[model samples]
Target: MSTDTDRPLWLSGHMAPVPDEIDAVGLEVTGTLPDELTGRYFRNGPNPLPGNDSGHWFTGHGMIHGVRLNGGRAEWYRNRWVRTKKLADNSPFLRDDLTFDRAAVHANTHVIPHAGKILALVEVGFPYEMTPELETVGPCDFGGRLTTGMTAHPKQDPVTGELLFFGYGFMGPYLTYHRLSADGELVESRDIDVPGPTMMHDFAITENHVVWMDLPVVFDLELVNGSMPFRWDDGYGARLGVMPRHGDGPVRWFDIDPCYVFHVGNAHEDEQGRVVLDGARYSPAAFTAIWSETGGPVSEVPAADAKDPATAAASTGSARLHRWTLDPATGKATEEALDDRGVEFPTHDDTRTGHRHRYLYTEADGGAIVKYDLRTGSSTALELGADMAPGEAVFVPAEGARAEDEGWLMTIVSDRAGKGSELLVVNAADLSRTASVRLPRRVPAGFHGSWIPDA
Candidate 1:
C-alpha cells in the first residue's frame, strides 16, 4: 500500500474474467483519467489507499489512460503507466482474445467530503498527443483524428466540496478538480468552466445549465466538428439539451425520444425552479420523456416481455419494468400501480430526495432492491434472490450513514463460470445479506460502483 509519496489518489472501476492474462479478455477495465484516458468505457477507478495491497485501478479510453492491478486471494493481474493518452492517434491496440479494449466506460464520481478534502471526479478523453495531419486544428474540437480527445461527464461540485469532471483532453474543454487531504495521503488541485471539445454525456449541472443528453449524428460527434462534414452513424436519434456553461446563446432543445442509452438520475427543482425527472430510460419503455419549469410529463410503465412462448422467445427483449406517472405539467399520466406486479426491469437505479423511490433490479431469476411509495401507490421488496445482481444500485441517504442504515448497494454477481465477476452487497431496505465476495472469477459486467465512505 505504498505507491510512495503516501497514496490515496484512488479511482476504482471493475469487470473481470478470462485471465490467462494480458491483452484483455471478456469485458475489461483499467484506470487513468487525469486525462491519460484509457479504454472499455465502463467500470474502473482507483485512489483507494489505506491498505493499498495493489487494488490499483483508474480507467478511461478513446484518448487512452491506464493502471490495472486487482490481485487478491490468488494473484495475477497487473499493468502500469502513471499516465498515457498523449494522443499519437491515441493508440492501445493488440487484441488476443479481444474483448473491448478502448472507449473508457464510466460510473463512480459523486463524492465530496469537504474541508479535509475527498474529491475524485471522472469522465474522460483528450490526452491528445502528436497524430495530427488529416487536417490539423485539434486541441479538442473532438478532432485530431480523435487522438487528442476528451468528452466525458459525471458531476458534483456544489462549491469547493470538489470532485467535478467533464472531459476533452489535449488541453481543451476541461473542468477537472480534485481535492482529498486530511492526511489520508494526497494533496489537492483545480480546473474549471471549459470551452472547446463538447459531447458531455448524461449531464445535470444547474446554477446555469450544462444539462446534457445529446446525440446529433455521432460519427463520433461529427468527427469532432471541424467544418461539420458528415458521415457518422452511431445513430440513436438524439435531442435533450440546455446550454450556457459559458454561453453561445439559446442552445436549448427537447424534441425527446431518441435517447439511445440514457440515464439521468437525481435531478431536483421544485419550490419553483420546476424540473423533476426522477428517473429515465428511453427504450424498454417504448416511450419516455419529462422536463419542467412549468411543463413536462410522459408516462407508461406496465411491462411485457411476452406472456409465454418459452420466456417469450427468450424474452425477445422487453426485459420488463413499468411504473409511469409523468406530470410534465398537466399532460397528466399514470400507470396506476405495478398494474399486476410481476417485474424484471430497471437495470439500474438509486435515487433519493423525497417521494421515496429506490429501485435497482435485474432478473429472470435474481437481484433486487425496490421501494417506491410515491404517495401510497406502494411498492416494496427491499432485496431478494441468489447471490443478487442488482445491476446498478447505490443509494446513500443520510450523511455518514447508520440509522439502521438505509443506504448500501454496490453490485456485480454474475459468473461466466469461474473468475467472471463477483462483488456484491445489499441492504438498502429488505434486500438483506451484506458482503458477498466471490471473485475468484467472472466480472465482465462492470457498469458502475461506489462506496468509499471516508476511505
Candidate 2:
C-alpha cells in the first residue's frame, strides 16, 4: 500500500505545433473536416486535466504506476495502433462513421486518474491491416462489436490486480496473453511468439526476462500509408529474443545474427539473465550502445546508396544512426554523437520514480517516444525530438489553491499558419519559463500523450 509520490509531475506529449494548427479537432471544424489533419496531445503540460477534450491521440508508451496505486492520480495510460484512413479510396476506414472504405479504429479508449479509478486500455490501431469488418465473426448485431486483429498493452499482475494483458495479432515479434477482467473481459488467452517479429516495437516487462529486441526486418511497410516506401532490409537478421517469465520452448534465443541495423532502444535485465540492449545503427548512421550479456546483437548490413540517395528519396529523411553496444562477451562496439535536442531533461526513466534507467529513442513522421531513467545510469538523455522540431511539454504542480513552488512545462508553438497549437506551461524542476494557455482551437498533428492530472 505504498501511495507513491515523492513529487509526481513530468509530462509532454504533442501534436499541432504548426501549420496554424492542423485541425484534428480545433479551430472549429469548419468546411467539411479540416484536411491534412495534425494536432495532438490528450493533456498538455502543467498537470492538465479538466473537462479535457482533444478527442484522442496517443501513439504509444503509457502505463506508469509510480508509488500511487490508483488514487495517487498518477497511474497513467496511453495507446494507439489505430488507422482510420480514407484520403479517398486508399482504404481502411469502415464503419458508418460517415462513409469510408477501409476503416478500423482497432482500439480506442482514453483516461487518466489514479489510485481511485482510471488506468484503462484499448487502442489497437493497425498492425498490417486485416479486416473483415475487423475479424471475430461469431458475434451479434444488436450492438455490433467484433474486432480483434488484436493489439493491446498493459502490465501489472505480479499476482493479479487485473490489467495484465499483452497482445499482438498483426503477426510476429509474437506476444499474446490476456487476463483483463475488470469489466473488459478477455479472461485467459494464449499464443505467445517472440522469435523476431522483424524488429519488434514496444516492450518493457521485468519480473524476469522480457527485455526484448531480436530486431531485423526486411519489409512489410506495416501496411503502407504515408511514407516507408518498402525495403524491410533484405537478408535481414538480428536476434536477441528472450521470452521467459514463465516461458516454454525456444523462448530464450539470442543470435544478433550478422545483424545489420539494430534499432532497439530499451531493455534491462539483471538477475542473471544478463541482457541489456539500447541500439541504433545501420548504413553509416553512428550511435551504437549495446551491453549484450553474451548471445549476439548481430551484424552484417551494408549495401545500396551508401549514405544519402537524395535524402533517401525524401520521406522526411533522417538517419543519424550509429549507437552500438554488444558484449554478449566480447562482441564489442560503441559510439554516440546524437543530441540535436528538442526534448531534454535526462533522456528517460522515472516515468514516476522507477528511479532512473535512461532511455531516449527518437523516430517520427508517425510516432516514437522513449524516455527512461528510473534512478541511475544507462547513459541518459531525458529529452528527445522529431516532428517540426518541438511543440509539446508539460509539468504543473501547485494545486489545492495554487501554492506555487514551480510546476508547468507546457509547450506547442508551430509557425506554419495552418493554425499553430499553443499551450505553454513550464517549470517542473527548472525546465524554465511559466504560464500561457492560449488556444483559439485548432489541433491535428496526432500521436501520443496521457496526463489527466486530477480530473
Candidate 3:
C-alpha cells in the first residue's frame, strides 16, 4: 500500500486534506485593497476526508473556503465542508438494487449565490443551499420545482436577470433546460434533445439563444463504479446546439469536430447574426490521458520519471483557448485558436453575459493567471512563480465600472514552499498584483467559485 508521502501528486502537498473547519479573523494584507471590492469570495472544490481514499479527484467531498472583504480590509476567512445527507449518513451512492441515489451527491464542483441563496452544485443531484456564513442549509429544489439534477455552471442573463441552466442524465430525457426569473421563481423547464448523454460540464448563452454541447465524453454503464464513470468515445460524435431563448423554436444542431469543452468564457451574437462562443478545448488524446490517470489509486511518481516523453504525453493534457463561431443562417460552424497557451477555468464580467465582452481571465496550466484580449487577440499573464499553483481567477466588477476590464480578479494561491495559502487580488486591466490577503492554512486547488457582492 502506498503511504501518505507516496500518494498521488494531487493528493499531496497543497492539495492534501484539511480535516477541520476553521475561522480566521482580520487577515494580513500585503498591498492596498480595493475599496469597492466589499463582499465574499467563495470557492468550492473537492476536499476529501483525510485517511479515506476518494478514488478520484472529482469524487471527493466539497469544501468551500471563503474570504470576506469589507471597507478595503480583509474582515475574516472561513473554510467549511458542505454537510450533506450523504456525509451525515455515511452512505454509498448506489443502493442494494444497483440504482443511483440522486441525493447522494458530493456537491463538490461549483458554488454560486443566486436569487438570495448560495447554492453548492454538482451536476448529478439537487443543489445544496448554503448561508453567506458558509453553513449548509440543505438540498434545494427551487421550492420543489427543480425535480431533476441541476448544473453547477448556470448562466445569469444580465439583461433579464434570469438564470439559464441545464441538466444531463444517464437515463432517458437525457438533457433538460431550465430558466429562473430574477426573483428566484422557477418559471420554465423543457426537455432538450441530444444524440445521447454527454458530460456537458458547461455551456454558453447569447442574447437570444442557449448553446448546448453534445460532445464525446459519455457515461459508461460498465465503469459506473469509477469516480468519473464517463469515458471519451470518438464514435459518439460532437455537435453544438443553439436553441432560441423564449420560444419553442427547433434547436439548430451543428456537428463540429471531435473534441470536448469544459468551460466557456463567453458567448454573444455578432453583427452577422452568427453566435460566437469561446472556451477551453480538449482534444481526444488529451481527454483520454486525463481520465486514465484519474482512476486507480493515488500514487506519486518521481519528478524525473514524470518527465518522460510518453509519461508527459499521458499526464500533460491541457486545454487550450479555442473559439467557435456558428452561423445559424448558413448552418456552418468555424473554429479558431485564440491562444496557444494552455488555460482553463475562464471567467469574465458576469454583467456581460450573453453580450460581447473583451477581456477573459483564466488560470494557466502553469503557475500563472492569464488575461486574454478578445478584440485585439492579445494575451497577458501574471506568473505566480513555479512553486505556487493558483485556482480559478474570478472577475469582480468595480463599483460604477466604466470599462470592461475595470475590475479586480481574485484567486486563491497555494504555496508549495511551506507557506500557507493566500487570496490574491489582481488588477484586471494590466494583470498586475494589487493586494493579497494571507490565510492561516493551505487551501487545496479545486474547481469553480464566485464573487458574491454584499446586498
Candidate 4:
C-alpha cells in the first residue's frame, strides 16, 4: 500500500484511480431529462491498476465511464478499462530498434465517435476501437494506411464530413497530417516541416484549412528515464501553421509569442481573410509551475511564488481564453486575451466547428461551467460549489435546432470528497440545470469525452 506522502498528486484526491469496474441499472435522475437525448455519454481518462503508477498523471491505462439515457430515463451505467497490450501483457512501447509499437499505449486522452465507429485515443499511438457496450475491438489503423500515430482530437468537418488530424513524433518526419474520407478511408497524408519535436496536444480547423500549434515544450533525451520525458525549451520558438485542406500549397506559418495551448475552442476565416483561432493559453510561469507539480521536469525558469496566496493561486497553470488572428496577406499575427478567469477544455457547438462561432463553453477550476458569448463579449456560469469538480462539458444540439446555442451541455461532476459522481445536463442558452443522473460510483476527473446520439 502507498502512503499519502509517497503518492504523487495525480494519484490522490479527485484524480485518484478507481480499483475496479462495475455496472448498475436504473440510476436516479433529478429534474427532467430531454427525450431527444437517447444515446450514450462516454468519457475516457487515465486510470492505472490497483498497485501500479505510470509515473505521470497522463500515462495511466485508459478507462471509460459510460452512461445510457433513453426516453427521459437513466437506463444504465458502466465503467471499463481499455484492454491494450500495454495493460494486459506489459508490452513495451519503445521497441529494441527505437521504433514505437503504436498499439502499446494508454489510449486515455479522448473518446470520440467518427464515421460509424467509436475510438479510444491517445496522441502517441493507434486508436483502439470500442463497442457501443464499451468493449475493446482492438487497434485500428485505417486498413494499415495510417503509418503514423493518430491524434486524439481529430476534427470532423461539419460540412464535408471528412476528418482531419495530425500526428507528431520525436523523429525526422516530426509531423504528418492525415485526412479520412466520409466513409472512414485514409485518403491523404502529407509530411509537414518543423524545427524539432514538440508536445503538440491539440489544433484547430477552418472551413478550407487546418491549424497547427508548434509550441516550445519539447522532448529531452536526458529526461527519458524520468516521470515525463519533456521539458520547456526557450530556444524552440512558437508559431502557428495554416495549411490548405485540399490544395498542395505549403503551410503558411505565422510567428507568435511563446505560449502553450492544450485545447482550442474554435477557429475560422474572418471577412478580412484572417484565420481567427481561439484557445486556452498558458504562460511560461504557469506552465512551469503546473508541470513540476504533475510529475514533469522542472524548467530552468523559477515557478510562481507559492508563499504568496495570490501568486500561488495563479500557479495552477490555469489557461485563460485567448484569441489569435493570423493574416495571410501581411504575414503577421495578433493576439488578445478574451477573459481573465482560469478555465480549460474549451468546447463549442459541433455544428459550428471550423466556422464562425458565437459562443464557447468551458469549465472553471472553481467548480463552475462557464459560457462565453464571443459576439457580445459577455459570459455566464453555473456554479456547482467548491466541492464539485466537473469534466469537459460536451455540447449536444437540440432536435431541429436553429440557434447555435440551442443545445444541452453534458458533463460528469465528481465529488471532491470522493463520495459519488453524477452526469449533469445543462441548457446551453441559459446555463440552467436541465437534469442530472446520479452515478453509482465516483468517476475521477478526466480529460475529454463525447455524446453519441442514436442513429
Candidate 5:
C-alpha cells in the first residue's frame, strides 16, 4: 500500500528507477578490458516510473541498463524503459476474466541475445524486442507463431543449439513447453499437464530430458492489491517432472516434500540415466519471510513457534545450494543439501547448460560472490569489500576456451555510499578481479543478465 516515495529499500534509493533514460559515451575504465570481451552486457529489472505504484518489487515496470564493450575498451552505456501497452496505459494487467492482454509484458526479468535478436522477457507476457543500443522494439511473438508467454530463463541447448523454454499461467493449461530452432524460429510448442496453476519460475534441461518444478506457490485472484497475486499454498503440494526431450508422453512426476526452487544451476543425466538437478532451495518458512519483506500483504498463516530452531530459520529466506537426484527406472527422487550458506542466483558456464557442470556461481546473502566446486565439495568467495554490492555474476567464456570454468565472470557492482556503479570482471578460475569499468551513476542491483559476444 505504500507509494514509491516511501517504498522499501528494494524499490527506493539506488535501487529505484531513474526518471528518464540517458546515454553516455566512453565510460571510464580502471583496468584493461579483456580483448576477448567484445559484446554488450545487459541486465533487466523492475524500475517503476515516478509516482507509479506496482506494490511489489517483482511487478514494477521493466527497465534495462546496459554497457557496451569492444576492443578492450568500455565503449558506452545506456538505459531505456521497455514501453509496453500496460505500462503506456498506466493500468493493471489482470482483466475481469483473469486473462492477460497480449502486450502486457513488463519485460523486466532477464535479457538475452538469441537468433540475431535481443529479447527482454517476463514470464507472464510476450518477449519484448530490444535493440543492441537498448531501445524497445515492441513485443515479439515469433512471427505470430507463439501464443503463450515466454520464460526469462530459457535454455539454449549447447549441443543442438535449440532454445528450450516454458510458460506458466494462473489459468488452465497452466504450463507449456516450447522449443526454438537454432535459426530462431518457433519449432515446437506443447501443453504440459500439471495438477494446478503454480508459480513455475524456472526449469532445467538435461542432455536427454526436461525437468519441471511444480512447487507450492499458487495464484490467488482475490488477494491482488496491485502486487504479485501468488502466495504459498500448502495444500498444493510439490513435485518434480521429467519428460523426454523429443518424445510425446506423459510427464513423469515424482512427489517431493514441500520446498520451493527459484533458479536451477544446471542439470544432467548421470551414467545411470538418473537426472541430476541442482539449485538454491528455500524452506516454506523462508519463503514466507522473504515474500513478506517485499512490502506486500500475504494470506494469513499460523505463526511459527519462537523456540523452534527450524521455525526461526524459516523466518528468513536463506537458501542453500541443494541437489536433487531422480532415478527414472525407479520413479523416485531424492534431495539433499549441498551447502548451508544463504545464496541465490546460482549460475554456471552457459555452454554446459544441459550437461553436468563442476562449478556453480552464486550471490551470497552477505553481498559476496561464491564459487562452489560440485565435485570436491569445496567453496571459494570473492568479497568486494565494504560498501559495495554486486548483482548476479554471468560467466563469459574466453575466446577458444580450454576448460568450462576458465573464462570470466561479470556483474554490475553498486557502491553503497552513493559513489557510483562499476562493472566488475572477475577471473572465474581464481575469483580475482580483472577489470572494473566505472559508469556515470549507480546502476541498481537487479535480476538476470547475459554476455552476448560480438563474434
Candidate 6:
C-alpha cells in the first residue's frame, strides 16, 4: 500500500477515490425534505480505480454518485463508474496515428439532463448517455450529427429550451459552436475563429450573443506526456469575444487583463445593449499554484511572481467573483471584482441563465455557501463549519416561484476526515438547512452535477 505521504494531493484526504460501487436505501434525514423538491440529484467527478492513478486529478475515470428523493423522503443512493472505452480496457485516447478516439475519454466533468437523456460530459470526448437509474447506455453523437467533442458546460436557453454549446481542439478550427433544439435535434453548427488552442473549459451566453473566453493558457506539445498539456502562456494574451446568436456578423473581441475563468455565473444583455458577464476569475499566480497542486505542469513564470499569498492560505483554490461589461457602441470592455472572497462553482436561477438576474450562488473556499444579491450589492453565507466541505450549490427553482431566489440549493457536503457525506438541501431565500440526508459513504469531492426532475 502506498503511504499517505507518497500519494498525490488529489489522491489523499477528502479528494480520495472510493473503492467500488454500492447502494443504500431509506437514508436518515435530519429535517423535512420539501415535497415539491422531488427529483434525482446526480454528480460526476474523477475517481481513479483502486491501486491505479491517472497521474492527474482531472484525468481519472469518471464516476457518478446519484440520490433519489420523492414524497419528502430520501429513497436511494448509489454510485457507478461511467463505462467508457477508456475505463473498460484502459484504451488510449490518442491512437497510434495521432487521432483521438472520442469515446475513449473520461466523461467526468459534469452531468446534465438535455432533451430526454442524461449525459455525462467532458470537454474532449463524446457525452456518455445515462438512464434515470444512472446506468450507462453508451456514448451519444446526437444521431451522428455531432462531429466534434462536446463541452460539459452547455447552456440551455430558458425561453426557447435550445442547448447552446461549443467544442475546442488543439488542432486548427480550434473552436466550433453548436446548438440543439428544444426537442433534442442537433440543428446548427458554426466554426468559430480563434487565435489558437487553449484550455477553454467554459463560456457564456446572452440573450442575443455567445461569449467566449480566449485566455492565455495554451497547449504545449512538450507537456503532452504530463498530467495536463496546457500551461499559462503570458505571450498569448487574454480576450473575450461576443458573437451574434443568429447572424453571420464577425465576433467583437475585447482585450482584457490577464486572468483565467474556469466557470461562468451568467451573462445577459443590459438595457443599454451591453453584454454583461459574470464568472470566477483567477489571477495568473493563483492559477499557477492551484494547477501545480493538481499535478499540472509548473508555470514558466518565476516562482517569485507565481506565489500568491491569498491563494496559498486557502485550502481550496482562490478565485473571486468578477464581472465584465462590454459596450458595442465604443468597442470597449470594463472589468470589476464583485467580491474578494475566494469562491467557485457559481450558479444562478436557470430561468435567468441568459437574461438579467438578481441573485448568484457560489461555494466559498473557506467552507460556506454564499449568496450574492446584485440588486443590493450585498452578500450572505451559510458556514459549513471546519469539518465539512461543500460542493457546487446547484439552484432548483420552486414551482410557481415569483422571486428570483425562491428555490432550494442542493449540494453534497463531504467530511474532511473522509468519514461520511450528506446531501444538504438549503432554502435559497433564507440560507437555512431544509434537510440533510446522510449518505452511505464518504463521497469524494467532485465536479458539476444537476437536479433531474421527474416529468
Q: What's the TM-score of every candidate structure?
A: 0.29, 0.25, 0.94, 0.97, 0.95, 0.97
Give the per-residue Cα lDDT of candidate 2 at 193: 66
- Residue-level lDDT tens digits of model 1 in 300-376: 32133122335323422222333333333553333322323333323222223222233433333344555544335
TM-score of 3: 0.94
Q: What's the C-alpha lDDT at position 121 in model 5? A: 92
Q: Could you tell which candidate, 4 or 5, scores higher by lDDT?
A: 4
Please give, for residues 288-371, the per-residue lDDT of candidate 4 as tens digits.
777877789884453323334575465567888999999998999999999999999999999888999999999997899999
Give candidate 6's error at residue 102 in angstroms.
0.5
Residues 144-167, model 5: lDDT tens digits: 998888998999999888999998
Model 1 lDDT-worst window of ten: 287-296
Q: Which candidate model has the greater lDDT, 1 or 2?
A: 1
Residues 1-455 of candidate 6: C-alpha lDDT, one tens digit per residue? 76767889889878999999999999999999999878899999999999898788999899999999999999999999999999998888889999889999999999999888999999998999999888999999999998789999999999999999999998988999999999999999999999899999999999899999999889998989887999988779889999999978789999998889999999999999999999999887778778888888874542323465554445244889999999999999999999999999999999898999999999997789999999898999999987789999999999999999999999999988788899999999999999999999999999999999989
Residue 253 deviation, candidate 2, in Å?
15
lDDT tens per residue, model 3, 306-360? 4455644654567888999999789999999898787889999999999998989
Cα lDDT tens digits for candidate 2, 1-455: 32213211111223222111111212222122111111122432111122222222232222211111122111222212223232112344434564322133322332222223333233343222211111122211112222332332344333334443344433443455444444444555555665433433344444444534445443354433422212335345555455555545445555543333423333455444355544434431121111111111224223332344552343222333233332334433234434332222111221311111333434322222222222332222223233332332333334431322233333344323334444443444444434333344433332223334323
Could you arrange the candidates by TM-score from highest to lowest?
A: 6, 4, 5, 3, 1, 2
lDDT (CA) per prediction: 0.33, 0.32, 0.85, 0.91, 0.85, 0.92
Segments of candidate 1 deviating more than 4 angstroms: 1-55, 59-122, 126-141, 145-165, 168-202, 205-208, 211-271, 275-367, 371-379, 393-412, 415-441, 448-455
Q: In model 4, where do residues sit more than 4 Å from their true spots?
A: 1-6, 302-314
Number of backbone collisions per candidate:
60, 94, 0, 0, 0, 0
Candidate 5 Cα deviation (angstroms), residue 87: 2.2
Better candidate by TM-score, 3 or 4: 4
TM-score for predicted model 4 compared with the true structure: 0.97
Ranking by lDDT: 6, 4, 5, 3, 1, 2
